[model samples]
Target: MNDKLDLKSTDITSLNIEKIAALFPNCVTETAEGKRIDFDLLKQELSTEIVEGNKERYRLEWPGKREAIVTANLPTTKTLRPVREDSVDFDTTENLYIEGDNLEVLKILQESYLGKIKMIYIDPPYNTGKDFVYKDNFAKAGNEELLESGQKDEYNQKLVVNPETSGRYHSDWLSMMYPRLKLARNLLTEDGVIFISIDDNEVHNLRKICDEIFGEGNFVANIVWQKKYGPANDAQGMSDTHEHIILYAKNISFWNPILLKRDEKQLAAYKNPDNDPRGVWRASDLSVRTFSENCYFPITGPNGQIHWPPESTSWRISETKFNELLNDNRITFGVAGTARPMQKKFLTEVKDGITPQTWWHREFAADTKIARYEMKDLIPENVFDTPKPSLLIKRCIEISSREGLILDFFSGSATTAHAVMQLNAEDGGNRKYIMVQVPELTTEKSQANKVGYKNICEIGKERIRRAAQKIKESLNQDSQDGKGLNQDSQDLFNLGNQENQANPGSDNVQANPGSNIDLGFRVYRLDSSNMQEVYYKPQEYNQATLDLFADNVKPDRTAEDLLTQIMLDWGLPLSLKIERKTIAGKEVFSVAGDSLYACFDHELDEAFAKEIAKEKPLRIVFRDNGFKDDTAKENVRQLLKQLSPQTEMRVV
Candidate 1:
């Protein structure tokens, strides 16, 4: 067997073309300028064609440290991640649903979406004395003996979760989340923000973690959402009805979320009871910021009596502005001129402020029941438990993201996807999503298993499909009733079409006469990580030396093509050349500008091997099972060093 190439021995920077090709006089020749060149010396060169064979792949080099450190072994599973492709999807969307272990999915996205995400909302396992599963190394579990005894399998490796009841509850959760958080940090764009939802279980810990990950300087407000309008009925002591959402940003110095728009309900509060030609208005304060010594003087009302300021809260404007309002009758006092002066605030003048107070569930309720209902309606009953409300998701998305990309790795029930569709329907906006999910085998005792689902990801896709169907149905219903919701139905598909008609199939197909909504989300399933290639089986016929070698006729394929493949596998640049020639009734190929040479004629001679190796390619790889003579192989190795001392050779 040939040893692996000693990569350490090949110094790319030290290579010099002129000096190395000097030894192989027959195989190499010099140009007029004394530049070394390989002659057409017939030898088996690297195969360019992707033949039917497994390829040995290489990975990026790992940095080495001198000291060895002991670490816990953890179990891990190959997690699938998502990628988004640019395409038209309805008018606009902003929600996403990812269905995978967020840790792995986040890592997979680090390269393509680093520093790009705006908001990240996750409801992780509360770790309330139950086993929270995450992929980890198994060796730390004393499974080395089992592995060595062949009691364990490789592909079906199992990862164990540390239950929260364990003494290291906090430690375990932190360890599991650290790397994932590190990766997620890279996905946040500079001005991006993140919102994490959590219960008391680890709210403090989560805050500290965010402070570390997003930098304490960027820590935004901690919003306390009234997840439940009523208190928990079965509370041991106190009923908990609220949850905290910790907000942070990639760069607080530049990050600012869009203020929530006031709904029509709020707008309906103002009325123009006394039409003053300024439209509808609300009453505001009329007092000055401070009781100005000069302004403390009595202001005569329409009755010409002294009007005193209020006891505490003062006005935002100066007395000058107040008098101006009084002159324009913008300031209103008592019904019969007996009340204190009040400024009139026109509805048109006030900017919609950020939603007030930390408590939000009052405005946006978290009816887990509603989410469950949505899931059951879309998928098999009880396939999933807690799903964040679409309203909650839509709110978060509206505040943080524009018409940009959204990602969800823990896409349970696909609520985020539904929210994106619903929000887009509400207000036209285009936002894309990439969802990643793992096909973790379903537990036999789980309801989803009874329904024949393999895992959560399966349910996730079904939910998206069903949601899209519902959205289309709802939009179509609206369109038939002559509602604006029909705008989203622009992509309706009809049944009839000529098989060969090519106007970009969907573009030419007319929408169903009554249809109203377009199915917007595209689904993709992630497959095993592998670079696919095609190959052919080598011919079975065996011949010591055929006329193919004797006539110096080359294979239809060129050596340059084969060399390119070798470079791909070797992780070398593809821009290398080859010189070909016939040698002793055999064809040989020498890498252009390099000492590398290859031949697989089985009838190779020792003298010919010496001549080829004389011009040392930095490294030479060959088929180990191909050489016919053991003595000749040994002689070739000995002569390789003699002819090209610096060349490292290998056989595979």
Candidate 2:
């Protein structure tokens, strides 16, 4: 296979254009430059009615709107390099923490994670005139720019700050968000949902863009979360104490958000005062504001006084149904039975939990002060400026997702990762998380820099480490308190035990309940592809140049690097469990328990090939130069065909 084009991501715009051309051949035309679409012809082909050009239409527009579309369509030549030293559990964890520009990271993830993510939660810049926005240079090649940025060094890329003085202040923020949201929408499953946190700064604009991207029909709700407890005393005018968490579903009809668990106060409303056989029950108002002639009836109280529906009001149910309900003791009155009759909703008959409401009070979800305290408790130094409380994110996870992949491209402070771990601990879920953050550098004299955090990504990674330890400790304590570890925990601990046996003296290692939880994540850093440029453009090289570039892979790349690239090419998840074993004195990497097997050794003989073939992996890969000669390569292929006819074999 050609390595150059095959290594890059799919060109989304070209595919879209091909789809359009297939439908309307007449509208597809070639220009002096390249293939071009005739808008007038396409419009005519789409509809028989005349389309007016000057007519006013309802649509969101900005200075860089067209450019934003181009950005999302462009394919990147970037790849994620595994950082084993930075990872918590390099070979076993199903969670991932990606450090890079989220836009490039999203492009790299498109093939492997498309339509697989169940929920996405992002807290992007609020565009408060001081926030930084990514400056996407569509003209430049992605690989060249990424290389020049020095991926391994301290983050020094200049982030564009959209100050109020800039001519395209609002436009810049919108432009930055437009393409990212479009890409994010593609990753969501059919029943998936996305929650975006934003303040009043650009809430209206955000809603318009989301309606266009996710469809107006899929718009779920605009939840008003009390982010702060009380009004700011130093406010110039009215204090802004709340933020909006806009939610949208991939397919609204298919999505059924789980109900929120009932808190003590909500459960307290139900009482078994009368010793009813149906357990505890709560009273509900029986009157309705709408004038329903059929429901405009009354009932006689136990005190022998007749009670009629209040003025301009009617019973919630018809008189016939009310009679049946009263006969079944589904109606309630005051303690003395003198007040108006009400409907009785038995706790046992109702759902186990309560439906989520649009307004989230600070008491249920934590406030800003509580969030700060949480950060302070974990890390003595406050590195993040506005770290969200874990409870707030926990609620979002509980409602939208259960046991599927969750992504957060704009994962500031890694709050989503922390919340995912906490929720998994509570409910024994196998939910996994993918957190992507741009390594935006901290201020020179800021607390983060002084405390040894060079960039935001450092703070985020550290937070996950601390959060995992804390969760494991808490779970272990619970186990000691006689609440034995759940099944999920036990399974995780067994896996951890197995891993610990393989690799000894790893940090943060614990026993029993602590080991059962997957509090570890694989870390990957975004960088240029492992293949050298000469591999893609071999025709430009002469005999001497070709000799120097004989091996298409870069000199610095390792066996693990090629394995990761193969995973991406094959659309395998980066978090898949990996194992390395020595067969016939040759090291072989096994991915996902025989789903894929690869040997990147420099030299291979017949014995090693036969040993690998005997295992019958679904897919196998080898280095082109690994074979001793042409005879060796043919022998290995013949052996594999005989031993495992179903296995797909490839060489790099």
Candidate 3:
């Protein structure tokens, strides 16, 4: 077998040689006599091997380490595709709408976004008798099947649903979820938090898994939301309408959960109509927890008759506290001289302490009626089913992430995204959202699928579009006075779209195109090609010459952009070096960084990638796309792979 495989190494290191072999196992297939032949067959195999090999190497190598200093005038532009009437691109806006298996989508996200997310909220399958389990190829490693699908095997199923009867019910759920959760955790910021909505079927199991991922110490609370208003009328006796939303923080110390505000609406319940100096307050009986002998003692009243306290009841506060309250004029006696002594609960003096309870009643959260109404209002004739109320999600966002990025991996009907948009609209705060949903083939069995929708993700995208339009229309209508139209015409996604004039009017706000106007989100699909690869044309011109040619094109500036710099500086092709790489330890594009020894596309396991990033190059270039694992993506070499691994890494 060794003789048949006539493999030899040159200047190429053992690592690169091994990488080449892994890409093509049949590089040295021979005849029975061990005679070499079939140059055509060998060339075809080698060419195919090189194609995959270069992509992997390009993804792992850094451009900063290259010997040359010439610019790489490689193409840099995204490929926009039409999806069911909508055009999507990477620069559309900050919000993202991916249409594919969420697991794969999460894997792709690890490259450009790791440790950058602020919050994540997901509503996974409950796995009840009717819940479908996801089939993940846990036995296989990496994304080999994903990369080779369709082109090689049309019959191959990338993803499938396992029935509830499978013996590996819990195992299957955990297996399918483990990798995704690990990846999701990487996307969170140090001060980030995640909320998972589940039911009795796997709440305990979910908690255990989350504890393993987010750490047990970060567990926040298990909030129970009232899903319905009335009790069950069925024969079994009881109806369950509530579900649980479990919360966990990336780091508890960094995250600050907000206290529900004591707004005017709630404060209106208290009254000061009688002009009492103590301010607005209500009345309550001052009670004790213990059968106190001192509290039970009889007291002399204005009527001359001595009144003794009830034998069974005692004051709520300690004797010392009660005496202090009496001394401070806080304790109130009966309106008339004959009433029992009570205490004035002044609204102004008390702190509005919000204790998030396990049972979420209708008053605290949006009721089912409101949830249904919200769906009907946004969607005509109710296109989707069981959409969560904006009010409910708004409360969650306000509590968990008052000001940060919010993610919804299971963005059913884009409820969480809509909630984030609505929150931003109300407070005028810039909060971004990234949504992921599976484009599972839809059928008539489902209401949304029946009405022209092909998958759950389609409904999600449409919902966001229609919802945004409605939000915009409402904002236009609610403007103060007649100047509402011009007061706030800017979009929710586009920030700083407005321009500033040299001399501004007292109330004049500059209007900038594509600025204040919500440019709508810049959307990029997980499978979409990187801008450089799509635009690069290597066959027509040599990249080395392209960099030098720029001088003739324009000599006034005597400077070049990253693309040109990469071509001249590194013998590595402009299309390759100015790519994505693992610098120091994090995933970044090299054209954007200033470091020597550029490992343009550095794999998470590559020590060379970290070493080069740690040594900071004048500039590093990397393939716009690379890295398949989420956990490994966060190891950024800010300066050193250990302490400062963050280097400038740009996508061509």
User: Estimated TM-score per prediction?
Assistant: 0.60, 0.85, 0.60
lDDT computed for candidate 1 = 0.55
Q: Which candidate leads in TM-score?
A: 2
The residue-by-residue lDDT of candidate 2 on 1-652, one tens digit each, is: 6556556789787677789989987766544344567787788777879865445579986667889999999987778889999899877899999998898889888888999999999999888988877777666544555464334244424256677756466777888899999999999999999999999989999999999999999999999998875577999889989999999999999998899777556778999888899998889999988889999876888888898888998888998999899899988877789878988898888987878899987655666666776777679897888988877888899898879998999898999999898778777677899999988888888999998998898999999999888777677776676443233333333343352242111112123453346789998888778887876777888889888877788889889988988898888999888999998888999999989999988678788888888899999999887888879998989889998899999998
Query: Model 1, 145-203: lDDT tens per residue?
Result: 43543324322323345564343455555555555666667777787777777788878
- The residue ranges of model 2 lying beyond 4 angstroms of the native Cα positions read 1-53, 141-158, 482-515
Model 1 spans > 4 angstroms off: 1-100, 138-161, 286-300, 303-307, 334-337, 352-357, 482-528, 531-652
Candidate 1 RMSD computed on C-alpha atoms after optimal superposition onto the true structure? 23.9
lDDT of 3 by residue, 1-652 (tens): 3557547656354455346556665553223232223344446675745432222221211122121111111121222122324523232355666555566656555545667788888887667755544455433533576453321222223544545544345555666566667778877889888888888778887888778778989999898988766676882746887889899999988987766655445566677644679788866776554687656655444466555556686666655776787787665555555666667788877766454456766545555555666666566656665677666677778776656678888787888888777667665556778777765555568776667786666777877887777766756555533332223322210111122111111111222221232324433333333223214554666777555442221222111233333332342221122235544555444542343233334354345455664455654444333333433444443334453345445434
Give the lDDT of residue 188 in candidate 3. 88
Count of clashing pairs, candidate 2? 1
Cα error, residue 93 of model 1, in Å, equals 12
Query: Which candidate do you rate higher for TM-score, 1 or 2?
Result: 2
User: 293, model 1: CA deviation in Å?
Assistant: 6.8
Which candidate number would show the highest lDDT if scored against the true structure?
2
lDDT, candidates in the order shown: 0.55, 0.82, 0.56
- In the predicted model 2, the residue pairs found to clash are 493-516
